[model samples]
Target chain A: MDEEYDAIVLGTGLKECILSGMLSVSGKKVLHIDRNQYYGGDCASITPLEELFKRFGAPSPDETYGRGRDWNVDLIPKFLMANGLLVKLLIHTGVTRYLEFKSVEGSYVYKGGKISKVPVDQKEALASDLMGMFEKRRFRNFLMFVQDVREDDPRTWKDLDPNTTTTQQLYNKFGIDKNTQDFTGHALALYRDDEYLNDPAVQTVRRIKLYSDSLARYGKSPYLYPMYGLGELPQGFARLSAIYGGTYMLDKPVDEIVIENGRAVGIRSGNEVARCKQVYCDPSYVVDRIKKTGRVIRCICLMDHPIPNTRDALSTQIIIPQKQVNRRSDIYVSQVSYTHQVAAKGWFIAMVSTTVETDEPEAEIKPGLDLLGPVKQKFVIVSDYFEPTDNGLESQIFISTSYDATTHFETTCLDVLDIFKRGTGEDFDFSKVKLELGEEEQ
Target chain B: MASVKIPEQKVILCGEFGVGKSSLFRRYAFNTFVASNSRQSTLGLDHINKEYTVNGKVIKLQLWDTGGMERVASITSSYYKFAEAAILVFALDNPASFHVLSQHLLDIVTYAENAKIFLCGNKLDLVGQVPQVTDADMENFCEQCHNLISATFRTSCKSGEGVEQMFAEIARHLVNANRSRMELQTVDKNSFKVTPPEDPTEEPACLC
Candidate 1:
C-alpha cells in the first residue's frame, strides 16, 4: 500500500492483465487491482449452471440437465486464433504454460439458409458440400492464389496490386460468386462488414493467410480454446505477473485515482494509499473518461444438442455474414461443450453476439437464434461499448476499449497493442519481448 | 519458474485481508516471512507454484492467494472454479476476521464442489500477546470449524510454525483426493454422472 509503483493497472481483464504481466516482466513495478475479486473483469467464466441462472434472476436449474459443476460458461465467450496476437503473447510471455488448449472442432459459415464448414484448403474447397462444381473450382483457384501471395514478392501479385486492388476486385479476378464472397470475407477472412471489400485487399489477404496458417497448425479449425474457458487467459497472465513480482489485489475498492496536475499520481483505497505515476484501467473503471461508441448484444443459450449440420462437432464457431442478414455487422455464434470442459456431457453452451445496430436488439438476432433450434435457457444482455476519447498522454490514465462483439481475439489484440503503443510511446517490440523471455528466465 | 509439465492442481487461499494469507503464501513459497511492519496487502490474485511429492508422484501445486478479495461475490466463484483444495486463513488475534470464515467456506463449497478444505488460524504467534483472542477460543473454534473441513491448524507465518505442516497436510489430502477422483475422472468425462461432490444429497449424481 505504501510502495510507489511505475504503473497501477486497475482491472484483471485480459487486456489489463497482459499489460500488467508485460510491464512486470519488463522490470516495471506494477500494482494491479480490480473492484471485482475475479481475474477477468467482464470476461469471466461463470460456472455452476445455477450461478449463471441466479445472475439472470432465473430459478435454480431443475434436475433435467446435468450437474451444475460441470459447466464453465463464459460471460464473454471468445476463441483464440491459433496464430493470433493473443497466442503470440501467450507464447512470448510463457503464459501458455499455465493452461491447456483444445482446437475448436469446426468453423462454419451461414449461407442462404443453411450452414457450411469453411473450406480451408484446395481439397476441402473441392470437396465442400456448400459449393457447386464450377464454383468450387473458382474458389480453389482463389485459395491457391492466396496461398501463393507473398508480401515481398511482386510475381505472386499476379498483375493485381493488393494494396490498391479491392477485395471485391480480387474476388472478381477468380470469377467467384457473391455467395462465395460472402463466406470468404465474413467467415474465412473474418471481416465484419462490406467495408473491407471496398478497401485494399492486403489486410483481407493477410487475414485469409492467418486463417489458413492457423488451420495448417491444428489441421481442424483456425481457432483454439483453453480447456476451461476464456477466463483462464486472464488468470494465466495474472500468474505471469505474480511470477515477475507484480502486486495484485482484488475486491479492494479503488476509492480514488489521485490525479496531480492532470496526471495520475497514485491510488487511494480505504486507509491504504499507494503511489504510482501511470494508471491503466478498463472502461468501467474510468467511466467518465471514455466515450460511448457502440453497443453489443449477446445471447447466451444452453442447449441439449449441438447446432444441426455442424457435423456433430462438439465445439464450433459459426459466422453469419452481415450481407446475408443485411446487417451492419456480422453475427458471431460460438459453441463449446463438455468436450472442451466448458459444459456437461451432452450439454452445449452456444453464445450469439453482434454489434447492436437497431433499437430492437432481440429482434435483430432472430436469424442467429433460429439456427440454435431449441434453447433450454437463454440470457440476453446489451452492453455499451466505450473507448477512450484520447490517449492517456494527458491524464496518464490509459483506459482500454470495451470488449468488442467479435467472437475472436484479433480485434481484441489490435486494441491491446494499440493501447500498449499509446501508453509506452513506443511500439510493443515482439523481438524484444521474446528476448526478454529468454533473459528473464534465469 | 517454468512449469514442469506434471499433473497440476489449483489450491486457493481465502480469508480476510491483512490476515496473514499473503504471509502464509510467502512462507510456503520463499521459505521466509514478510516483516509485519513492511507487509503489503496482496493486490488481486497472486499465485506461486510449488512441486510436491504426493503419494510417490510429483504434482505441481498452484497455490493461489485471493488478496483478501474473497468478499466480492462475482470474483469468489472464479477462484473456486477448478480448485482442488482450499486453505481458509484467519488471523487468530482478530475475532472479526475469524468470524468471516463461514462465508468464505461457503464460497469454496459452492464453486469447488469436491475440493479438500483446510482451516488455518494464522498469526498464531500473537495469541497470548494479543488479549482479544485466546487459546481457549482457538480450541472452541477448531471444534466447530473442523466439522466443516478436514483439519484445523494454528499457524504463524512469523515463527514459521505450522505453515509447512499445514501445506503438507493439504498437499497429501489433495493427492489422495486427486487419485480417487482420477479413477472417476475418465468415467466422469465420458459418463453423465457429476465429477464428484462433497454433498451427494444436494445434487443428484447427474442431470441438473
Candidate 2:
C-alpha cells in the first residue's frame, strides 16, 4: 500500500485495461484500480439474465429466459476488425491466450428500407443486388483500384492524388452512384457520417482496403466478437497486466487525487496512500477534467431469433448510414447469439446505438428495431458522451474518452493510442511486436 | 491431422500477502524458490500451464497468482469470475493469515459461487519450529465454510513437499467434475476453445 508506482490507472474499462497492459509490458510499474467490483467499467457484460433485469430495475425473468449464467450481455457491445489495432494490440501483448474469438457472420448496410450485405470482393460486387450491372462493373473497377493503390507506389495512384483529391472527386472518377457512395463511405469505411467525404480520399480508401484485408483474413466477415461477449476483452488485458507485474485493485473507493502544485502525485483511498508519478483514468473518475461533448443512446434488445435479412447469421453487424435514414448520425445494430455463448441456446442479443440527434431517443432507434422481427425484451440507456478538456501535458493525469456509437473498435483504439502517447511520451512501436500466441498455445 | 483439445481450467492462488502464494506459484511454475527474497518478486503469474492426466485424459491448469493485490483489498472480480478452482493459501506459522480465510472465503463464494475451493497451509517446513495454526484450527475453519472446500493440503514450497500432490488432486477433481457436468462432449464443444489465428499473410499494417 505504501509503494510508489510509475503510473496509477483508475477504471477497468477496455481502454484503461489496454493502456495498463501496454505500460506494464513496457516495464513500467502500474497500479490499476477500479471503483466497481467488476472489470470493464462501462462496457461490462452483465451475466445471469436476472442481473441485467436487476440493473435496469425490471421485474425478474421467467424460466423461459433459461439459466441466468448462460447469458453474457454487453452493456456497450462493439466488434473487433480482424486487421484493426485492437487485434494487433491483443496479439502484441499476448493477451489472446486469455480469450477466444469468433468471426462475426456478416456485415450489412441499410438503404431504401432494406438491409444488404456490403460487398468487398469482385465476386460479391458482381452478385450484389445493391448495385446495377454498369454500377457493379464501375464498383468492381473501383475496388480493383483501391486494392492496388499502394501509399508509396505512384504507379497505382491512377493520376489522382490520394492526399489532395476529395472522396467526391474519387467517386466521380469511378462513376459510383449515390447509393454506392453511401455504403462505401459508411459501411466499408465505417465513418460516422458524410463529413469524411470532403476531407481527403486517402483515409476512406485506406479504410476500405482495411475492410477488404480484414475480410480476407476471415472469409465470412471482417469483424470478430469474443466467444463470451466483449466483457472478456478487459479481463484479458487485465491478465496481461498481471503477467507483467501490474497490480490491480477493484471494489475500492477513490477518495482523492492527492494533487500538489496542480500535478497529480498519488491516490488516497482512505487512510492508505499509494503514490504514483502519473495518473491515468477514464472521464468519469475526474469529473472536473472532462466536459460533455454529446450524448449517445443505446438500446439492448433480447430476441429469440437472428436479425431479419441477415441470412440467418448467428452474429452480424448492420450500419444505417445517416444520409439513408435522413438523420445527422449513423445508427449501428450488432447481434450475437448462442453460438457466441453470449445468450441461451435459442436466444440472441442485439443492440441498437447511435449519437443522439433528437429529443425522442427511443423513437430514434425505431428504424433499427424494426429490423429485428420480434424482441422478447429490451433495455434503453442514454448516456452523456465525454472527452477530456485538455491533453494531460501539465497535470500528468491522462484520461480516456467515452465509448462511441460505432459498431467497431477503431475509434476506441485511436483514443487509447493517443492517451498512451500523452502519458508515456513515446509512440507505441507496433513493428517490434510479433504474434506470440501461436507458438505459445501449442 | 486431428488436434486434441485439452480443457483448460483457471486456478487462482489467493490469500493474505506474504503467505507464500507467489512462492507456491514459483515452486509450481519454475520448480525453484529463493529463500533470501522476503518480498514478492514474481514477474507475473500468466498462464503457467501444468498438464495433469486424469483417467487417461489430460487437463491443462492455467494457474493465476494474486501478485499482492489482496493486501489492499483490491483483488478484481475478474480474477474470480470464471475460475474453476481457488487455492486459499495461509502460512502454517502465521495464525493471522489463517484468521483471514473467512474473508477470502466470503469473496470467493460471492463472486465465484461455482468455483471449487481448496485449503492450502503453506510453510510446512516451518511447522517443526513453530506451528501457529493447528489441524483442529483448519477443521473448524473448513466447517465454518460449510464444506465448500473440496480438499485441503499442507505443503512446503521450499522442500517441495505435498505441492505436486495438491495440484494433481485439484486436476483430478476438476476433471471428474467436468466429465460429470458435460458427459464427455466433443473437443469442438469445449468452452473457451481458442479461435484459429488470423492469416498473417493477408493482414498488413492498418493504413489508418
Candidate 3:
C-alpha cells in the first residue's frame, strides 16, 4: 500500500499510539506502521484466554459460574484523564469495549504434591498476608521513618533528595526486620538497583513520591493483569489507530531509516519505500539501531499447565532473585491465560535473561525444564517452540537479544514452549505439541 | 554585519520528575490541568511556547521542560545553556527530591549565575496528607538551599490553586530581570550589544 500523511509514526506501541491518536484527533493525517505482522508491539494479545481455556479441556458453561469484571478499572480512569480525546473517541466507537479478558479458574499447588483451587480474592489474600507481617511496632516505626524522610514539599530541584541513606542503610537506620527489608528490597530492585539509588535524599524522596502517587492515584500499588490476556491493550490501540485513519502494515519491517540532508525523511522496508517526516521508535531500539549503544537479552518459556506454586491465578508476576541463578541468568515469571473468564487450560510464561556467551541459538530448551520438586510438582522445561504449529506438534524455541522482542512474541511458539517447560518437567515430551518458529519480517 | 535581536525575556521550568513542572506551565498558559504519569523519560528536551503581554508589550516566553534523571543529565543540560529565568519545582510531599534543589540550583548557577530563579513547592492540595509546608517553612528551606535562589511559592496543579499567582510572579521577575540587564548593558564600558562570543578553541559550555 502507498500513502502520504502530515505525520508518520513508525511504532504502534503505547506512547506512539497516544501521540498518533492525539495528532489525528487534531486533524492531522497520520500513518502508523509496525514491523511485526501484529499491532501492540509488546502489548498485543493473540491466544484469546477463552479459546485457550476450551482447548485445555475446560468444562461446559453450566459447570462454571461467575461474571468477569473489568480488571483495568483503576488504569482506565488515569488513562482517560491523561489522554482525554483519545479515550472519548475510544469509548464512543466501542473500541475500548473490544479489549477483553477471561477470568479463568485458579489453583494453588500445596505441599505433598497437592493442588487446590485458589480463592477469587487471592491477590487481596497475598497483600493482607504481606501487610500483616509488618504489624509489629518495630516495623511500624520503620515505616514512620520512611514516611518522615519522604516528607518534603518539593516543587523545585532543591526540595527533594533522599539519597543520604542507601536503601540498605535506610533499612538499617529504621531497624526494619530482615524479612520486610528483603521483600521491599526485592520490589525496589524490579525498578532500580543500588547503583541508581546513590543520590542524595532529594532524588530518593522523588522516586518514593512518584511511586506513592502511582499507588494512591491509580491504585496501581498491586499491579494486576487484564482479565482476558495481555494482548488487549495493544489491540485496543491498534483499533483506535484504525478508526483515526491510520494504517498498520504487519510483516513489513523497515530495513533502514532513510535520512537526507541530516534529517529523517523516510524508511526502506525490503523492496518498498515508506516516506515519513518524523519517527518515534521505542528508545532502546533507536539506541541500538541508530545510536548503537547498550544491549539486552530476553528469554521466555510457555507451558500447557499452570505453574505449580501459583494456583492458576491471573495477574501474578514473580521477580526471581538475581543471586538465585547463575550470573548469566535473571528470570521472571508470569502466568498468561489464567485470569480470563474462559475455560481454557492455564499456561505459564517465564522470561529468563541471558547474555550472548551463555545463550544458545539452536539448543534444545526442553531438557532444562524441571519440576519444582518439594515446592510443587509442576512440570518445568524449556522448549524451542509451542504446540499446534509445526506438523508434529513439536516446540520451536528462540533467543532474543532484547526484552521488546521476547514480549512481542509472548504468545507465539517461543513463549508457549518456555511456559510449558517451566510448568511441566524437562522430560515431558512435546512430540504432540505443535510448534513453529516466528518469521523475521523485512 | 547583519544585526540580530534577542527576545528580552524568557522563563524556564526545572524540577525532578512528576513535580508538576509541566502542570504549572499548562495551568498558566492554557488554564488546564492535564495530569500525566511518568512513562518514558523525556528524550533530549521539550519546548513549549507562550505569549504573555507584559507592561503593555507582547513578550514571548519560551518554556523548556528538562528531564531530571541523572542518566539523561547530559542531554538535559544542553537545553539549559540559553535559559534566562529558571523556575525550580519541588514537591511538598517528597522531601528528598526537595533537598536536591540545592545541587540543581548550583548546576544552573554554574551555567548562568545571573539567571532569575524561582523555587516552587507544588502539590499544595496534598499538604494535609503530607507534612504541612508553610510559607515560613519554605522561606527557611530556600535560605538553606542557597541565598542566590530565594523566591519561593506553594502551588497545586490539581485544584488550579496558586498557579496563576505563581506565573504572575514569574512574569514580574522576568520583566524586572530584563530591565536590570538592559540598564547594565547601557552603562557598561563594553559594547551595549554584547554578542555571545563564538570561540572555536573553547570547549562547548556544559548546560547542566
Evaluated at residue A79, the lDDT of candidate 2 is 91
* DockQ for candidate 3, C-alpha atoms: 0.01
Off by over 4 Å in 1: A1-5, A8-12, A29-39, A46-72, A121-123, A159-161, A238-276, A285-289, A338-346, A429-442, B1-6, B11-79, B89-100, B119-148, B151-175, B183-208
Estimate TM-scores for all models.
Answer: 0.80, 0.89, 0.41
Displacement of residue A369 (Cα, Å) in model 3 is: 6.8
- In order, candidate lDDTs are 0.79, 0.84, 0.43
- Say which docking band candidate 1 falls in: incorrect
Residues A1-442, candidate 3, lDDT per residue (tens digit)?
Answer: 4555555666655545544544444445656666765455544443332332343365432322222211111101011111122333334333343332222222121112222221112243344333454334454554344444524444332322344445555555556655444334433223222343344444443444333322332232323233334444455544444434455555556676666775556667787676765554443334333232223333334444555555444434344322333223223333443334222334344333322223452131221233221221122222221122212112111111122212122223233234223322242242321211111111
Candidate whose TM-score is highest: 2
lDDT per residue as tens, model 2, B1-208: 4975666788988798888888888888888887845644555554577889988988898888774556544565567766889999999998999998888888788667788999999999988754699988999888987899999999999998999899999999999888865445453453332343656564443311
Candidate 2 lDDT over residue span A137-159, tens digit each: 88878877887787778888999
- Which 10-residue span in candidate 3 chain A carries the lowest summed lDDT? A70-79
- lDDT string for model 1 (B1-208, tens) is 4863365578888887678887888888778876867744554335667777976887677787764433222343445666888888888889898777778778787777778888788887887845566657656765775565777788889999998888888878777767767656645443111111235344211100
Provide the TM-score of chain B versus the true chain B for each model in turn: 0.76, 0.86, 0.72
Better of 1 and 3 by DockQ: 1
Q: Candidate 3 overall Cα lDDT vs. reference?
A: 0.43
